[model samples]
Target: MPTKSGSQRKRTALLLLLALTGCALRVPVRQLRLPDKLPPEELGALRAIYLVLRLADAETASPDKLSRAVALAAEIRRALEGPSSRVVAYQITASDEPADYFIEQSSATGVLWLNLPATEPDPPPQEVDASTATASARPVEASLKAPYHFYAEPGHRLILKDSVSAAHKSTSTAENQRALARLLAANLAKDLAVHPMTLHRVVEEGGEPELKEAYQAAKEQRWPAAVTLWKKVSTALSDDWTPLYNLGVAQEKEGRFDLAQEYYAMALERENSKSRPRKSTLRRLRNILATLNRLAPSSLEPAKGGAAHIPAWLRQKMAVLPMSNETVDIEAPQVVRAKLHQALASRGYRVLPLQEVDEKLKEIGLTDGGQLKAYSTQEIAKALDAELLFYSRLMDFRVIPLGIYYERVVQAHFTLTAAASRTLHGTRSTAQGAADTGDVVLDWEEKVQYQSVSEPKKWAEALAWQILERQVSKILKVQLKEETEILVLKCVNKLPAYFNP
Candidate 1:
């Protein structure tokens, strides 16, 4: 007896009830219907791998072979870039050293010809038949699989997952096929953290105590003591990069970029450095480099990875969090709700007053970075009725970095969250900018720039925030290598019903 409209209304009500009751169905949507192939942009990201290659022998490759070797290197360089992006190349060869990589063969028409004794030698005949009217020669070919030496960055492993027709997952291609194979094999061996050459250098190393004591000295702001302790530690630690890193920081604090750069180089010799400077380190380093670059700008172009990318849309919708002053706490829900309301609206996004979200956040305090784990997405969404919500975590872990800036490495973790009811997008960036590295006198140059932990770090912190703001805004365009698996699990667990696994 019910009308069709009445039945439709009842069905809609039932679906809404199911969604509200945590019984919403999950769509099997991963492995989304991707185009049969990857776009050029994605592949472009992985090209031009920095390889450390070594040749089989140099004396033999000289002149005729050397000419071929030089020619082969040129060919590989040309092939790394396509009709698109320019290949930024860097070659560091020690004087008179053997070539790092070489081609075993060169293309001749459709076939490959090995750089053999360009003229073949006559092999002696083993047997002769007096009765035979004629004798035939046996066919011989080059050893195609020539052994090449590879010494690449450590802790990275290359798996020879099935080869693709078009150099799938390769940093570059060799003019000759064998050189390409060597690169693949070397990547597969990327897992070895210690090179045989390096292991030979740390003879009977035993000095963790010295390093620990040096760390203590730096923590106490006793720069002189820390420098001396690090010197002893380095001797005991087998010329470890820690001292060099500490020394670099000390030099930076002293505003000695020229000298500090030397220590940075020494630190990098440790290999496969995650120790690579973060944006903060580079910003500080860049400011120094730009100043130093004017004196003698070396060929090494500054790496651009530290720069931030922000989209225009995001630029209009930023939040300005109230700076933490000991008197006011950010732990209250009203504070967070109010800031969100004011900031989002000021940034040009349509939003209601903070009073609207207060009731919802009151049940669970939504203020402060540490307390973010306490909120549920449904609760957050229910509170603001926002299709997407943005959260900023303002932290003041002072006393720590201030202590380490004189001697050791200081680690800082920062995150910005951009969330939808169910779908979430965010970035969790870490900065491990060490202030010093090596055996040195910290106060030897306090009057100079780049030295000591002082009021200047306020400028450093400001730069960090500036970079972070840009990084957060780039989410829509640049696919930053952000791994969500490393995200704060507490918030991950509370994602909205729609994004539930």
Candidate 2:
């Protein structure tokens, strides 16, 4: 029983009150938080599978758009490279290989198209003459069965819907596409690298208050408090690496590098005794060790009267000739030469660079010949302006694989002599008298075994280099103080003296 104006005003006030009430009752958004570091276990067991990635635009033959498409593909490749990439190995190939998956990035359409093997049964491989080798001749050619076109759903596809068209509209479209490609790569990596999450070990009830307190202090960035608590726990649980690791972290946070290094080393030793230490812990320890090495005084500095006062023949410019390799591997000589060069340089000797020596060898017709020693070192040295020369011969070199482990065996003989001294540096032919034989300086036989999951050639090369490195160290007469790290050995020998010096 109110007037019309009064009734309308009352209804408006009620509507306003209800709107405010609804706004107050609405739920707040939950904050999104990501883990500080992705756990390694999440990647699961590695299964070797090849993923062939090819750019779709590469087939179009459009030079105008090819550059942008190639750039996008490169971005994807960079994102895919990491430790977690153990899941899927990638190679860009046009040749028909038994590929497990094929990913084609179409930058023109801004879509990542995936192709799956067709459900239809594969055709049998056809035999062909070896001279006419092609897909038909390969045994696994059937595995390259035609793939079914996969239409990626919204989640799987990189939808740069307007970006492709915008390329014609603006010059910055290529940059936008590049940004989208990166975003897509990150999303794919995250999805593919799923692994088990590590649970925090904190007791809710009947737990040691001191341990929990230490964790809380560390979390709160209270380095001093955390260090004190962790140290007490370390004493109590002398065998545990957890408290020790925590102590190291706290010390590092507190800027006490020396103490941090000690704790980390202790933690690493303890953890290594049980099993492989955490990757993060191993990385931190290695970094700290490198830093310590940098800070430590270098022992590579030549002694006061070391090589400086050596006889001129030994002190003057030296040359290391490539070792003669009987092995089938063509790279053995190059690897040995590199190791020798590194060793010679550390001794404060003036050794001609490898390329210069190679050029001189080519000019003297010693680049490839019957025997390494057959080449006249004196003539080569005269050509190279060097007074001392090193010659080595590999008697045997083999890398044998035993299951997952690789064993590299190397046997070699070396001789260092005056490049120009006829009495000390001459070599005999089998037809000539034995009195023409050169003076042999160092002869070594190195055999080493190492376990590696990588390719056999790489593992063998690494072991071979180690053998050469140790041999060089022995020749220099320096005590190997740090076995874990290879130190450049000092040169301590009197060889071909420079007549001029």
What value does the lDDT take at residue 20 in candidate 2? 57
Model 2 shows how many backbone clashes? 8
Displacement of residue 264 (Cα, Å) in model 1 is: 66
Instruction: Compute the lDDT for candidate 2.
Output: 0.43
**CA shift of 150, model 1, Å:** 37
Off by over 4 Å in 2: 1-314, 369-371, 404-406, 422-501
Worst 10 residues of 1 by lDDT: 439-448
lDDT of each: 0.33, 0.43
With a 3 Å backbone cut-off (N, CA, C), the pairs that clash in candidate 2 are: 42-195, 312-497, 312-498, 313-496, 313-497, 313-498, 314-496, 314-497
Least accurate stretch of 10 residues (summed lDDT) in model 2?
101-110
Question: What is the C-alpha lDDT profile of model 2 across 1-501, one tens digit per residue?
Answer: 855698889999999988856433121211111211223322222111123334332222223333333443455445434332321223322223212111111101112222322122233345666696743522221111112111122223322211111111112434444554465445443433222222221211113677778777655656578779878987886656778766655554444557766987897787667655677756766664554433312121211122343334334587777767776756555655566677667645578898898788888777742344565555666777876666666554555544335444544455555443332124422211112233333222322223345566576666666567555754663313231012111111111111111
